[model samples]
Target: MESKTTKKVTRGRPVCEIKQAEQKAKLIFSAKQLLNIKSYSQITIRDIASEASINSAMIKYYFGGKENLFVELIQSIADEQFSQFEDLGEHKKPVYLFIRRFGEILQSHPGIVHLLSEEVLNKTTPLARAFMAAFPARVSKFLPPLIQQETGISDTKKAKLAAFQLITLLVSPYILKTLRQQAWQIDDTEIQGEAWAKDLYRHFIYGLKESNTNEVES
Candidate 1:
């Protein structure tokens, strides 16, 4: 019988590569955490490095600079948020469930809303402008398809309009938290939770269906 030879298979990533990847991830995570508590203008490379327990030079080496790091952070957040809506397309759940889950996500990660608001008000930097432009385009890409799927409304214009309305409803409470509490006696936590989600869903469905009926009649 001929001797059999077997090649050894590599099982996992190299230790150094794994460590390097982990270090990069730590930087990203630290940036996100700090952004949650402080605005972009206030956060520094040293602050992020301190938070991540890595050298500040590593941030410059890995991401080039603070602005680039922040832009990457915003991209990651937008990707995550848009991914949630993509799942809805596969399951085809009721629109109410989508609204409720969206509210829950916003409430859980209020930092994202705050960051978006800040970018809109302070559109002085290229990073801010890129983020502001990318976000709505991302939403428009995912939302109208989902609305069409749920409501069976084929009018692209109406679907887009409804999408804008739903987005406004979902985000307004968190964006205007202080004003909401003082003027409307409603807090962000309450507004972006299950109860408010359900109420908004009911009202939205009613309005959507009524509008569709009017469109068909006309």
Candidate 2:
């Protein structure tokens, strides 16, 4: 029962598993590197493989195709981001910190906005729908409390509306950067950074206070 051949086979299984995991991680890394320089449609399986210095066929073996690979990439990014946002609950200035952190994330991953537009907002494929159901839709539930905390807007409906508006304010600059740049020569640097975040926070707070005042008067 303690034959050397049995022990050899058992030990080999772990090595095999480790190698496969490394290959899969290589593919994912290659995909992310390519995505940074090129649009999703512009990237091919070979490009990722070449960037990774791995065999091209391994892409199909590991991720099935570019679509699934990108989905996994986005999912991984979302998981990290969601965890970071959850940690904001412990921050004293969660609202402003959230806005600044959100802006930095978008700026760092310039391709992510395009991927969202192409995959989730513009299409209703099963993968796209699943992505929305899994991440953004679920994350929406977490924002209203932050809104309520910052603005003292206790009404559930009003807090939810404020949350949606705040997110749109933060995301619009990135989503519309190309058009805004062409039309007004405005750049992302002007709309991002600590100064811009502080300005946004002040404006949002002012608007909420004005609304509360008007409601009291009415």
Backbone clash numbers for all candidates listed: 0, 0
Candidate 2 TM-score over all chains jointly: 0.86
Estimate the TM-score for candidate 1.
0.83
Q: Each candidate's lDDT (Cα)?
A: 0.78, 0.78
Off by over 4 Å in 2: 1-15
Writing each residue's lDDT as its tens digit, candidate 1 over 1-218 gives: 99999976434322488787888888999998988788777889999999998888888777899988878877887777666665677765557767876776676665677677876555768786767765777777777777788888889999999989998988887888779899999855677567777789888878887899898999
Best by TM-score: 2
lDDT of 2 by residue, 7-124 (tens): 4433222257788888778778778777776877789888988898887777776678778887788777777777778777777778888888888888888777766665567788
Global local distance difference test of model 1: 0.78
lDDT of candidate model 2 versus the reference: 0.78
Every model: Cα RMSD to truth: 8.0, 4.4
